[model samples]
Target: MSVNLNNKKESWYMFKIGLVIAFSAVLAACSGGNGTKNGEALLTYGNEAPTLTQNPKQLDLLIFGGTAGVGLETVKLALARGHKVTSVSRRPERMTLEHDNLNNVKGDFVKSESYASFIEDKDAIISAIGVDASSEKITIYSEGMKNVLKAIGSNSSTQVVTITGIGAGDSKGHGGFFYDRIVNPFLLKEDYADKTRQEAILRSSQSRWTIVRPGFLTDEISETRYRVLLDMDGVQSGDISRADVSHFLLAVVEQGAYINETVFLSN
Candidate 1:
């Protein structure tokens, strides 16, 4: 009878051990099957590669008189927007703005070859050149513009965007008595006459172009708000800050919305 009892006890112990083993196997399977043993941990055991997006191509731009007051700031803004820029100026040494894609070249506007190399591979050109209004200055505003345009047209498929006065060319007499009678007769007759001829040159060029006619330019800060006059109407009749004018020049280039069109901007 004692022998029988020992056999029964051994059988019971084996059963208990088997049960424990099965329980452990179940726990292991459950831990591996679920994302986490509990609800607190994340499972990254078989994560695959992440999806990627393609980046768009960037445009290249060239600036004439880029070191000038408003033009300098325009360069900074263009660089910030990821556009590659080449700045050509009489005093190229004054360009202190640093950017990986910006190039500064020195040249004379009247000599096409001087700026020919710089505009060779450029996509577009912004002529921010300004001449002094002194009566003794023979290279009036229009003459300077003509020289710069001639240089820009020398090479590559570069489009041009340039700024001239509001009462320039056919845009004259737009500001009523203030611009026609009072302003142009005294302060701007010589300048306006030259700008008129300049506009004619730009219009007749084979290269794509835009002539920006702005009224009574000032060094004041911009409100970022202005109007665009497609026709001659409402032009030569309003005021715009130089900052805003530069902004418009760069903005129009990027958008390509105003191609082969003449825009007159004002407030």
Candidate 2:
């Protein structure tokens, strides 16, 4: 039997078209339909937290002290990652981050009724409460944390991340001579005392809490790559950007890696 050249060419052409269609379908499935697949939404800039097993999740995040510092950065990063964020602060109008997923609430952290309602059904809570270095007597840190703990009572599934200083808990010696002996004792004595109390409150709670102790914070751009010291025995205080610390906070919430643990952050 003689083979028909035209017939063979048509068969090959049809096979090529079929292969192309199948390949395109696979790419669409992997990339997700409508930019979401199996509850994973397309992320911007990928996963900021390198430790996470998957892309960052869109969570209902309740942030205290979100007007400035690391708290502000947390709000921005969470919103950028498509997370629904509710920032509770005394001055909600001060939060300039305009995002469809961002909600600003005017509340006082020290008062349970002020911000406690926002805590219900929240996936995670990030507390960046702090006091001035020159504060003679400080109760804001401890009292605010106390209110948060009370509001989150018995919610073991709710993840909580709190930012304290290096000299707050067992990491006291890690701040070097100046921070440990002088700055902590003189400039931050009252503030550290409240932080110590705050840590104690968090430690006693049954919730999945992670306390972050970031070394001297700066306003520099984020390096993202920073050192996380689970043990502060031989560690020394270093500097890290507020942006990096906020990134780590979101990562911890996403990965749930450091549950019921306190880790020191520096770069």
Worst lDDT 10-window in candidate 2: 32-41
Candidate 1 lDDT tens digits, 128-152: 7776542332444466567766665
Which candidate's lDDT is highest? 2
List the lowest-lDDT window of 10 residues for candidate 1: 44-53
What lDDT does model 2 reach?
Answer: 0.75
Could you give candidate 2's per-residue lDDT for residues 128-166 as a string of tens digits? 866645434688888887778788888548898889887
Cα lDDT for residue 96, model 2?
A: 82
Give the Å shift of residue 2 in candidate 1.
99
| Cα-based TM-score, every candidate | 0.69, 0.78
Residue 84's lDDT within candidate 2 is 95
